[model samples]
Target: MIGVDWGTTSLRAYRIGASGPATDRLDRPGGILTVPQGGFPAALRDAIGPWLAAGETRVLLCGMVGSRQGWVEAPYLRCPAGPAEIAAATTAIPFAGAELRLIPGLTTEDEGGVPDVMRGEETKLVALAESLGTALACLPGTHSKWARLEDGRVTGFATHMTGETFAALSQHTILARTSVDGPDVPEAFSRGVDRARQPGGLLHHLFGARTLHLMGRLEQAETRSFLSGLLIGHEIVAAASGVTAVHLAGAAHLSALYAAALARNGIAVTQHDPDLVASGLRQIGRSLGWV
Candidate 1:
């Protein structure tokens, strides 16, 4: 079986055997946004062409590829959703002599009852259920998600624009002028996290980065890390309250940053492999009897 984790800017394909783990993997830059109209099928073929030729006919996909903007829109399932519910909601599309299944996203309300939605991450959560059980899970990226899982079901979640905000500020704003490209500075990051806990809000604290630089207290090389820390710190502080521990899934660097911020707040973190996307697709496939 072929498992695809297709997002907005990237696509990953995993070739899973009838049993055991994925035997091979492929990655491509032809994300949904990169593909022209009516080209998703061709793009997908190019990504997993070899696997298809090898007679791997069953394919399960997750993420933005099932979004309204992707090849076909797979409607979202309401939360508290589990593998069984997600499997029941899967949408199958016939393509290239194969039965392609797209996993639907999840939707729920925030604490204030405003609607919230997530794709891709739900699949990872499904893979994580057996290990993490009922717990809080965080997946940090352009739009970071903090989700509450109970009894292997996603109960509710909230999104934070931390990564997007950091990118905008560090590349498009005045802060960019002072930013330096280098590895993260732990001290600078820690200072930013500490500042987040002060009386002033994030807006006020953001300016402090400039002030510290002007005063010769913060170096140019440390500006970006400081800004990152501040944003991640605020994100954690706002979303992680009352949760004693969090199951983190994503790239190692990003997860490490979130782990640092979480630890500073006395919250424990358990990191999971970012490759859970394939595992997740397999889990959903099994539930649907497609694997």
Candidate 2:
């Protein structure tokens, strides 16, 4: 079996073993955005050719691989969707003369008229929640999401685009010239978290990240960490303050960052192994009775 988590910037694949889990892992730079014309399997095979089994059963994928911008759009199932519902809607796209089972995404609207959509993270969030017997979860990402669940049913969620804002401000905004990578200074990050915990002034605090660097209180590298801490900590404080037991999802690197931000705010966080999406997808496939 082949499991894939294909997103905008990267594509990750795992070759499953007899234990019903991935054995050899592979990664490629080309993702859904990179394959605008759709050569997903060739790209993946090129990356994982050494581990290809004689008769690979199928490729189970989630994320932007099923977005409208992807190789194919697996239309989103509505509110209250489960693994079974997502699996039932899986569309098999032919690539490199192979069939790939694509998991559809989910969508719903909040009270504020904003639309929420999630792809790969949904499966992992559900699977991990079930594992921990957790009923409430917050998965941080380019667009961070807060999921509410119980007994495998996803009740509702809210999404905050904190990661995207950080990227935009650093790379595309005026701060790009000054921003640089630095260590995860706990003190600086904690300051950001405290700033975020307040009920108001996110806009002002956001500007402070830039101004602090200019005023010389923070070094160039620490400015980046400060900005990251400010936005991400603000997101955590706003999203997960009342909700206990947030399940930080996505790639390990991102989960670690969010975990730290949450910790700075005194919130208890649990980091799920990144494989639950595959397990959840496999579980979804088995529940759908896919052969």
- Model 1 stretches with alpha carbons more than 4 Å out: none
Tell me the alpha-carbon RMSD of every candidate: 1.7, 3.2
Error of 2 at 152 (Å): 1.9
Kindly list the per-residue Cα lDDT of model 1 for residues 169-244, writing each as its tens digit: 9998889998778989999999888888787899899899999999999999999999999999999889987778
Per-candidate TM-score against the hidden true structure: 0.94, 0.82
Q: Residues 1-291, candidate 2: write the lDDT tens digits.
A: 677888898888876543456666777778777773647567767765565555675678888878878777888776676667677778887765446788878887888878888888777865765666546677767788888776675667788989899888889877787676656776776667777876567788877777888888877767777778888887877677676567666687778778887777667787766667667666666655643
lDDT by candidate, in order shown? 0.89, 0.73
- Name the runs in model 2 displaced over 4 angstroms: 17-20, 36-53, 94-100, 171-178, 210-221
Task: Indicate which candidate wins on lDDT.
Answer: 1
RMSD of 1: 1.7
What is the lDDT, from 0 to 100, of the residue 263 in candidate 1? 92
Per-prediction backbone clash count? 0, 0
On TM-score, the leading prediction is: 1
